[model samples]
Target: MSLRCALQLGIPDVINSHGKPMTLSELVAALPVHPTKTHHLYRLMRLLVHLGFFAMQKVADNHFQEGYLLTPASLLLLQDNPSISRPFVDLVLDPILIETNNCMSTWFQNDDPNPFVTVFGEPIWEHASHEASVNHLINRTKASDSSLIGRAVLVKCKGVFQGLNSLVDVAGGTGNMAKAIVDAFPDLKCTVLDLPHVVADLQGSKNLNFLGGDMFKAVPPADAILLKWTLHDWPDEECAKILKNCKEAITRNGKQQGGKVIIIDMVMGNQTWDSDDDKITEAQLLFDMEMMVCGIGKERNEKEWAKLFFDAGFSNYKINPVLGPRALIEVYP
Candidate 1:
């Protein structure tokens, strides 16, 4: 709740733009708040400090001498940060998404597909389609996440797209991932495939195009297909069907033409070296639970992921441990 409060108040951005530690009086002046509510700001800051969002220190011998600074977690919440995660924080905390948590128990009692449906009377994707606000929230959150992933993919997994002449990003939200690839490899033609509504007003570049379609039905022919944080939203059987379609897409174009499918997702147990940091492991487990409650997906280990690849008729694969909890998986036909 404190985290939510801080986000609502834009505390991270306030301190970040200030360019220095912010004293309580300075923060209070910056906020569009009532003068009588100054004390409330200090109480809120105290709670956020205890929650590890901010660090407070006394700089002078006075009642309001305390100053607050952003912690590592809070830095990510800054709106101006290139890899800011504020949008994701906002989306998860939005009323529509939060209401789903309240209906979790009710969903378990009935035959509804998910708690989101019980609360909003529709699935997540459907709700996004009809509700403009929800759709914007989802897209903005995805765009922020993609910016972070883009840095990792370019720095660590550049080899994944090395020799590909053309590539397609399936379910690529807002084309952030595709934009990164295109900027890195100017010679490669990149395409983003998603629903029509998602790509309706989106513009493409000289070498990049947006094609709206369903992944289960068909995918555009490309030397390589990129699935970044996409497949995990579905169950194994459904993932298999999607992978099968990808395999067919690659084979139809000519399997001998050095075609491959690159996947970016979390692989549990892949971070054994970081076991000393219990917080990292705890976060991964928490995400697993979040997936269980919000979607049919769950993070998988190497073995589980390999099984899915083989089930989809892939002959060979390689897992390059690059991103922290996630990895760059190369699936070959």
Candidate 2:
């Protein structure tokens, strides 16, 4: 709730744009609230500081007065940051999702598929389909996240797309990932495959095309198929089916130079470095719990991921732990 309050109040953006550690008076002045509420603002800042959203430093003489500064987590909330996670933070903490937590108790008593249905009177996707506002929020959140991931992938994981002539981003939300790839490799033809509604209003570029279709039925033929955080939204069997389609899509490229599927998703227990071990693993587990509550999915460890690949008829696979908890998996037939 405090985090939500902070975001609503634009505290992170305020402190970030301040260009220096923001004093309490400066923050209060910048806030839209009444001047009489300055003390209340300080209380809120104190709590947020304790929660690690902001850091407090002694400023005035004698270390009596203090100034507040944005932390790494708060920095991601800055409105101007290219990779701002504010939309994701807002979406996950939205009132619709928050209300579902109360239904968890009753949800376990009944035989409902998930708690989301119990609260929203429909499944997550069904509800999103009916609610235009929620659907827009979800799409925006996904696009923002993709932009952040795309920047990192283009810079650090360029090797994944080196020799590939054609690539398809299956279930690609708004073509942010495809745009990034196309920008980096203009010669590589890129296609974004998603639902009709998702691609309806989205624009395409010279090298990137948007295709409206279901992955369950077909994916466009390409030298490589990219599935970024898509498989985790499904059960193991469903994921296997999607992987099979990806395999078929790659095979369509030809038998002599059969292609591969590039997956960017969480692979639990694959964290090798200390940073990955602590931060990435913890975030993945948290996301797993979130998926369990909100959708019919869970984060998979490497062995589990590999099992799905093999079950989908892939002959060889390699996992590169480059994207935090997520890995760049290459599956070849």
Candidate 3:
């Protein structure tokens, strides 16, 4: 909550603007909080500093003796940062998610397939289908996440897109990933396939276009199909169907010599960071639960993923673990 409070207060950007460690008095004066509540700000900052969002430095001066500075984590949360994670926090902490979570215990006691269904008598998607405000927040959060991941993927995994002329971003929200790809490879044609509501009226560029369709029915033909953070929302049978359609799209299209399907999603047991912190592992587990609660899927281990690919009739595949909390998987026909 303190992290959320700091973000709500724009404390990181304020500290950044100061260009130096800011004393409590200076920080309070720079904030919009009530003058009578400056001590509350100090307490909040104390917790934030302890949580590593900000660093406290001991400084010697006549007027002030110590100050706070932004940490790397807080730097990424700054509103003006291109890779800001602010929207992610908002979505994760939104009342919709929290309310859904509150139903988990009752859902486990009942016959409901998922917590969301237990709470709202419908799938999360169906709920979003009617709530434009919630849908918009979902889009903002997804676009924000894609903006950060797209830039990193282009730099660290350019080879994934090498030699590809036509690509499709399956269930791609707002076409951020496809746009990034087309911007880097102007010759490559990129299409984003999603529900009608997702792609409706969305503009496209010279090498990029939008297609509204259900992946369970069909996917647009392309040399390569990209599914970033998409498959986790479904179970094995549905994922298999999507992969099968992807195969038919990439191979029958006659775009390349056995085209590939590139997937970016979490593989449950693949995390092996040397860093001893348990937070990442915990977050992954939480995400697995999120999939379970919001829809009909959970994170898979390597063997589970392999089984899904083989079940879809893919001859070969590769996993690249460069992305945080998720990996890039290339499935070949």
Candidate 4:
């Protein structure tokens, strides 16, 4: 929670604005905190400095004061980065999610859809819809993730969007992913299809537009379909249905060439040459558990993914393990 505290206190922005190492006294004075919390703030800074979020500099005895400075890791946490995950951090650490963790054991013993339902008497999405803060958290978290992945797709993997005349981002909340894609590929016609509540009142650019609809019912036709961090929030059966629907959309949209559906989600237990890190494995497993806790979906290994693709009537597929734990899957009809 130290990272959250740092963000809540706006420490990174403050230090960046300071333009120099900010001493404890100077920081405490600048913060919008009570005078009694000055020493407490120092302790917090000391911990974050050790955690690599900030750097420590010891000043000369008489000339200046010893202070803290921003680190590269902390810079990403700034509100300015296109992929800033501050809202994501806030969503994960929110009281609702934290409390859900406490009900897992009981959840396994009971027949609740998820631990969240056990605690709040409804599914995560249902509760989110009723609570403004929860709704904002979910949308903001997805937008931040889209910003990061969209950037990576543009810089590291431009070939995916190459030669595509039109693209549709299924469940593209607030059109961040669609905007990012259309911005990079000026000639491509981009459409964002999401629920009305999420996409309502959102403006679109010349090449980007929003469509209010349900993915389960149907997805709009396009040369390529983008599903960023989308399918992981569903069970295998539902995912198969979604994939089948996407296949139909692609066939209907690009009848001559038969377009592909691009998915960005975790391919659990991925151990390619470059991604053999134990930490990544642990994180993948942790995410699977989180999925279980939410009663939505679980991460899939390559074998499980292949099974889903084949079941959904896919003829060919390719996995691009470029985005760390997450993989960009191209499934064709």
Candidate 5:
């Protein structure tokens, strides 16, 4: 939660605006913190520095005159950064989500879908739909992460969108991913398909539009369907249903010949490890557990993913393990 506290205190932005490494006394003066808590701030910074969020840099030629500087990881957390992931950090550390862990033992002995359901009496999405603040937080979190992931996809897998004349982003929140794709591929028409409540107020341009609908029922017909980190939020049955809908959408309108579905999600044990650090494996495993606690989804291995694809009527597929812990999968009908 120290990261969240740093975000809450706008520490990253403060250091960034300083234009140089910030001294301890300067940070204390710039912050709203009480003078008596200056040493506490020091302790927090020490921990953060050790954790690699920030670094201690020498202000002058003396080792004793060191100042705090934002590290590469913390640079992306700045408030004004387009690829900022602060909202995601906020979502994971939210009180309601954190409390779900305490109910996991109860959940295991019950018939609940997840611990969040065990505590709140409904699935997270169902609860979020009824709670405006919660819904906003969830959407903001998705949008923030999408901003980063979308850029990465464009950088690493630009060929995926090369020949596509039209595409649809399933469950895309606030059109962050679609917007980036549309900006990169100006001639390609991109549509964002989401719930009615989520897209009701969003505006679209000539090449980019928003459609409110359910992926389980139908997806808008397009040359390609993009599912970025969306399938991991659903169970196998639900994922199959969604993929079938995507298949039908792509096959409709006589576009079956070259249509495909592009999925960006975790493929368990698919990442290549250079050493014994195994940070990617650790993240994927932790995310799987987080899904089990927050929802009914779980990370899938290649075999499990293949079964889902074949069951959904997909004829061929390819997995590109280039996105760190996640993989970009191309499914063809």
Candidate 6:
């Protein structure tokens, strides 16, 4: 939550705008905190710095010997960043979700489908579908994540879209991923399929459009199907169903050469990081628990993913560990 506090206070933005290390007093003056709370800012900064969100740096300013500077991880917290993850942070740290998480023990002792169902009286999807506010938060969270992860995929795996003539981003919230893809591949027609409420008011352009549908029932036919962070939101059976729909979508035209399903989601125990292995592992673990508590899904390893693909009637698959802590998997039919 300290990270959320920093984002709330616009600390990263302040430090980044300074262009140089910002002294403690400068940060105090720039922030909106009251005079009495100025002293507490130091404690917050200390914790944030220790957590690697910021670094203590020697500044030339005479007001203080050291100042705070934004770290690489903190850059994503900047409000103006195109790939800002603040929305995800806000969604997870929201008070309602926090309260739901607190009911984890109660959920364990009961027959709830998940902790969210335990507290909210229904699954997250039901509540989000009925509650406009919750639905907006979920969409915003997915959009924020897609912007960040999509940038990496475009950079590292642009080839994944090269041969495809048409693509469907199943559950592509708000079309952020589709927007990026369409911009990168203008000739490649792109469609964003999401819940009706999620895409109801969204607009599209020449190469991009939106469709409201359920992945469990059917996915729009396309040369390639994109499932970025979609399947991990469901259990094995549901994932199998989604993949089956995707298989049918890709093979609908009977053009077998370039039809494939491109997935961008976390693959458990698949990191080959030269450093920060522990940090990546911790993030994957935390996200796995988040899935378990928030939904019925769990992160899958290569073996599990392969089993799901084969069971769904896919011929073969490939995993590219290009996205840190996540992977870009190509499953072919």
Per-model TM-score on C-alpha atoms:
0.92, 0.93, 0.95, 0.93, 0.97, 0.97
Top lDDT prediction, candidate number: 5
Best-matching candidate per TM-score? 5
Tens digit of per-residue lDDT, candidate 4, span 50-162: 88999988755535568788888898789787889888789878888889998889988998888988999988877776787888889999988888888887787788888
Candidate order by lDDT, decreasing, is 5, 6, 3, 2, 4, 1
lDDT of 1 by residue, 58-156 (tens): 655554576788999888888778788888878777887678877789988999877887777777888789889988998998888888889888999
| Model 1, global lDDT | 0.84
2 versus 3: better TM-score goes to: 3
Tens digits of lDDT, candidate 3, 45-163: 88888889999886556444789988888988988887788998998788888999898999999998899899889887888888998888888888888888998899989988989
Clashing pairs in 4: none
* Candidates ranked, most accurate by TM-score first: 5, 6, 3, 2, 4, 1
Q: Which ten residues in a row have the lowest lDDT in candidate 4?
A: 270-279
What TM-score number comes out for model 1? 0.92
Tell me model 5's lDDT, rounded to 2 decimals.
0.92
Candidate 6 positional error at 10, Å? 1.5
**Superposed model 3: Cα runs more than 4 Å off:** 59-64
For model 1, the stretches where C-alpha displacement exceeds 4 angstroms are 57-66, 255-257, 273-277
Q: Which ten residues in a row have the lowest lDDT in candidate 2?
A: 249-258
